[model samples]
Target: MRNTPDQEKELDESPLTDGSDELYERLSLKVDKGQEPLRIDKFLVQRIENASRNKIQKALEAGMVLVNNKQVQPNYKIRPLDEIVMYSDKEAHGEEIIPEELPLNIEYEDDDVMIINKPPGLVVHPASGNYSGTLINGVAWYLLQKNKELSEQDLPRWGLVHRIDKNTSGLMVLAKTEKAVRSLAKQFFDHTVKRQYMALVWGDLVEDSGTIVAHVGRHQRFRKLFDAYPEGDHGKEAITHYKVLERFGYVTLVQCVLETGRTHQIRVHMQHIGHPLFNDDTYGGDKIVKGTVFSKYRQFVDNCFAVCPRHALHAKTIGFVHPATGKDMLFESELPADMREVIAKWRNYIANRLA
Candidate 1:
């Protein structure tokens, strides 16, 4: 779980700070003496227990496999004494998702998959403090109601392919069958899946379109929050491309496209550049990062915070190839009501200020 916000909380069960689905692993191995040249995927498959060749190859396609610190294809041959580094992303689960009768905003569903429009303040899955009333619990109950009853072993993590933070409302795809889970996992692993989010940051961007490339990892001091390393030395690689959509002087609305899913990629990247998401308490967006220190202005900002008491981020669109049909699937979601109301307030306030 991540520190999104209260009321309009941002919560995701992903291992990455971005709240995107996937737990990344870094592995390094030296080729032994008299080692025969083998394809990198095959090499990883043989060396890493419980990892399949298909999964390893998927990691390669996603540019997670590297030779001498450079991305390599699955077919790349491993040479002796060559330093090999690999990054692999996979789903993490603790136990079965217990079925609970809770409200779920299911967008689309079929035999193979289900598309969900997750609402803010909803935990995606059960964790230590939140063992019930999660999206996974609701999903489990929904699936059981529609499909045949099955043993606990039949399901894994409620077939979730990835996650968004709890306070960040957005679209998520869930697999229905074992094959769907494996196929969807491959898509995410390969970085072929497309994810876009809409966010309101506390400052105006200098450029209408720009990219934020940084290394994001857990904060050394505040373990709950993430810190961005713009130098790109430590932490996972994260790239976020943004285009300004609307600007409200003190805040700007932008659309963010993710090339790599790292924990808190958007929030941390924005904050690193000095524009944290509005009302993102964990990242200090809750304070007056932008605008004047005047009492009147401060009061206005406080009013805005009360209107939308959470980080201003929404997963607006997600696109991927269907696991079973091999067809392109894209889903879009409208901004939630709370976000809409807050943006409206900003618009009105700006207009009045100009007048």
Candidate 2:
């Protein structure tokens, strides 16, 4: 159970009048001798309505619970005649939380596997920055709504086989059952899943096509970034095959195929080369250059950065074998509006400049 700060203050003020007055609420419970000594948090979870185990643990860690007028450890045992006091300052409000019925863009669905076209900015799971309204939550709600017509177990359950970054929009596959999950996970372990990406970088590539073979690890100075080291102590072998698609003055469009999937592989590899993705905040592509009268292309470059917030990259395609049916499946997503707009504007700028 949880109460807002304002609600708690109002409840406390309404019950008290004099400045020296004390307000207290007592709760009495009989301890069962047969039951083993349980942790304070575990015990509180059973007593508190609408309170989760995590919430109870936080309360215990914050010293909000007391046993027999004395603060006790989480593992302390409760004896007969022991009084438990929880100073919540106000009564907890209980509200039923129902999952929101949200629409899902499912590309393919089968007994064993499911493919989804994940949009940019939709987080795959719940994390620090995002709590509710996630792709996982939406999937669960979708399954629940489907279960009304079919059996509860018949609905397609998304056991995450692999994950894509929040900002990287593309095809993602999920498993429906435990057997399918194991089979698909084994395929990923065996390097059978083929992944590809398309990126627009800031500079032209000297070579039309090339392979970036490097040992990728966390950067020593900047923990957030990855670096390629010659010595290769703690990094993993990463291979990226890139081919030139089109050229626009100093900028180039390229398609990247991955032999191994690492965190931020495309972004890091692009930065390792002379050409980094435009508007990439992490690997030094943040400045917006407005084209002057002499350099008429500067405004187009600035507008490209203004339209796209993050790196100019997208997970274009993914192909893998279906775990349940042992059939081949391939999925793809087109460039999002932001990336498409950036490319269209850049193409127009280059055409005008050459003309």
* Candidate 1 Cα lDDT to native: 0.79
Superposition-based RMSD of candidate 2 using all C-alpha atoms, in angstroms: 16.0
Per-residue error for 141 in candidate 1, Å, reads 0.5
TM-score of each: 0.78, 0.67
Q: Give Cα-based local distance difference scores for all models.
A: 0.79, 0.65
Query: How many backbone collisions does model 1 have?
Result: 13
lDDT of 2 by residue, 23-66 (tens): 12223244444546677677666755566787656445545456
Instruction: Give me the runs in candidate 2 sitting further than 4 Å from their true place.
Output: 1-100, 148-158, 288-296
Q: Write the residue-wise lDDT of candidate 1 on 184-224 in tens digits.
A: 76577667889999999998899999999888887878777
